[model samples]
Target: MNEVEGRGLCLHNNSNGNLITPSSDDDLRNVFHQIRTTKNPAVINYGASWCRVCSQILPSFCQLSNKFPQLSFIYADIDEWPESTQHIRYTPTFHFYRDGERVDEMLGAGEERLRDCLWLHS
Candidate 1:
């Protein structure tokens, strides 16, 4: 199987509260636009499967996704999207997007900090 398949990072049907991956910059932009059009903010977790910090934050990330269905929860793998890497630094970066524009970003995997940021954004 491919590395993407092994990491479970490949695209799958996105139901409510599902994680979606956008391959290219255009695709990522489209996803951001779609989410912004809904008027609710989006929380994008740019993570890598091999990163231990990312793995630890998955449960909280998953819970946040369910808690805020109005907000789009996107899981973007750094390794998968090289184009976006330049914009963001660090392994697990949290970006809040609204109106197709980035409103705020919180880097790293501290649960409390993430929660606080999400609360502030939403």
Candidate 2:
């Protein structure tokens, strides 16, 4: 992964390349707002730091992001953002959005399936 500094923020390509980790609720809200306003395709990985499966698929997820620069990738740790992730039933749940609407969702750490979903949406 690479770290790029921008606007005073040390933006690092987490396990998922191009992934952004919002430090606060406001930051998270802004990310969603930007996605909606820009109507860009985005994928959100709802995972937890303590989840073994979440950790296992991260490398592949990051590689997938690098493969698709047109898509916005984000990581939300359920442990840190419980209120925002209450609906999540499992770790490594991926939510795909396009044109400001969620088009598909996949649960679990299936790297191949995730890549296919991204290919289809992107």
Candidate 3:
């Protein structure tokens, strides 16, 4: 079984679903930069507190992260970090980055898409 599967993460539309009050502009940049430093692929879930899909699927995302320690997982609150990801057109967006560069992306918090994203990168 794949690592994600081993952790009980289903890569299907099972739907899912951070608060950082950035003290200053530098704090926001630093957080972004820190996540970008991972040599392995990084997964960021851009979600909102009120999003139902996010609520459903977030546990799976965290399980996948735990199953694969080689990758970094970051969660962003849309309300808190508008400037950090303003270019995004959708909520509950999943992004995969490698060495500070985005290598893959998925839209929505559906299980199928998330499975595809993690499988594609994994």
Q: Highest TM-score among the candidates is held by which one? A: 2
lDDT of 1 by residue, 39-107 (tens): 668888988888888878866776666655667777777777767656766879998977667899888
Shift in Å, residue 17, candidate 3 = 19
Angstrom error at residue 20, model 2: 1.0
Candidate 3, residue 22: how far the Cα is off, in Å: 8.0
- All candidates: TM-score: 0.76, 0.84, 0.69
Residues 34-65 of candidate 3 have per-residue lDDT tens digits of: 75674556677876666778757777776666
What does candidate 2 score in Cα RMSD to the true structure? Answer: 4.9
- The TM-score of predicted model 3 comes to 0.69
- Residue ranges of candidate 1 with Cα displaced over 4 Å: 1-5, 8-15, 23-26, 35-39
Report each candidate's C-alpha RMSD, comma-separated, in the order given.
3.7, 4.9, 8.6
lDDT of candidates 1 onward, in order: 0.72, 0.78, 0.62
Give the candidates in order of lDDT, highest first: 2, 1, 3
RMSD of model 3 against the true structure = 8.6
lDDT of 2 by residue, 90-117 (tens): 8889999999988999999888899999
